[model samples]
Target: MTVDESDAYVLRDELPDPETFAHLREVAGMGPRSLEAIERGLPNTIYGVIAVHEPSGEVIGMGRLVGDGGAVYQISDMAVHPDHQGKGLGTGIMDRLEAHLEAEAPAGAYVNLVADVDDFYERFGYEPVRPGSKGMHRRIE
Candidate 1:
């Protein structure tokens, strides 16, 4: 999608529709998700934002926060459509999520995410896990 000078991008506090959300993930080289899972999971987001291309009404980007409401929080599912990458949409998504965390996260809440690009997240003040503290995960088979 060619973003013309006149094309307006709007960021709204809402989850992308499942089709657009899944498509963005697929095109962005992420895994696909079932419609049923999308339907069930989106409404549980503590906060989320979707960037829409005004001219085409396309969901070009998205970011979401998830985890226990009080003690733990995580920023996840941050993705922008390949065509829309480098247009500041990723920063916009992170800006919104960071704002939410700043305003709402409890004082002692532990926030974290696994970064594919350390530099991108480092700018936002997410540092490497401290020495002797390893991040681990197990994928569902």
Candidate 2:
């Protein structure tokens, strides 16, 4: 299926839909609770644009911005399906997310993303937090 820009709307709508939650899990290598977290937190978060294929209506790429609106916003769960990689879909999602953050986020709003690829997010203007600072997480078990 061709990745049409217009199909972005379909992705946006599907981001919160439970039907596509499984697809998200596969892409992110996460479990059902991850999907639950997304569903639970989606209302309080700011999700940016998503891009999908038109013909099969599959969710090919997705990214989202989370955190408090004014003080902090984080880019999270950016993923493109395996079959859809190397075609700039991830970049397209980031472009949309950045554009949204740029236009909407207040000054001093800290935007962050935990990137799997070392250099990829740098191209979109993300950098390591600091020398001493580090990313922390806790998993429920």
Candidate 3:
């Protein structure tokens, strides 16, 4: 049965528990993350938000911000369970994250995220940094 999101959903200022976090990532096809890293890192989150199915108490979506307490921050681990996509859960997560950034991140701080879907991030005022600059990453062995 399709849940009528207007009333049966909740956005909470909380991180998903490790298992739920991992499961959401998998279901969203975001690939795998180190469980050990997640265990160590989640507690240090600057701010995070989770969407839940109120009746089931299940995490349906989540997003988080992490970085040095002062200047730079990155939005990471944004995902929604496959069954729960297209219902504005991702937007709800971004709304909370944006509020936290507005409230806490200092002026001139750089906020960035790697986007699998540019259209989604673009809606939040993010633009590609191509000709003038670029994004680079190195995975640790």
Best by TM-score: 3
In candidate 2, which residue pairs get closer than 3 Å at backbone N, Cα or C atoms, i.e. clash?
none
TM-score-wise, the better of 1 and 3 is 3
Q: Give the Cα-based TM-score of candidate 2 against the true structure.
A: 0.80
- Please identify model 1 stretches exceeding 4 Å from their true place: 1-7
lDDT against the true structure, per candidate, is: 0.86, 0.71, 0.89
Candidate 3's TM-score? 0.92
Worst 10 residues of 1 by lDDT: 1-10
Ranking by TM-score: 3, 1, 2
Q: Which digits, one per residue and each the tens of the lDDT, describe model 2 over residues 1-141?
A: 786774442445225354465576576664455656656765665765566777777776677788887899888777777776777787878887888888889998988877777689999877887775888878887
What lDDT is obtained when candidate 3 is compared to the true structure?
0.89
lDDT of 1 by residue, 8-122 (tens): 7889998888888788888888877888888888888899999988888888899899998789999988889888778898999999999999999989899999886657998
Compute the lDDT for candidate 1.
Answer: 0.86
Note the clash tally of each candidate: 0, 0, 0
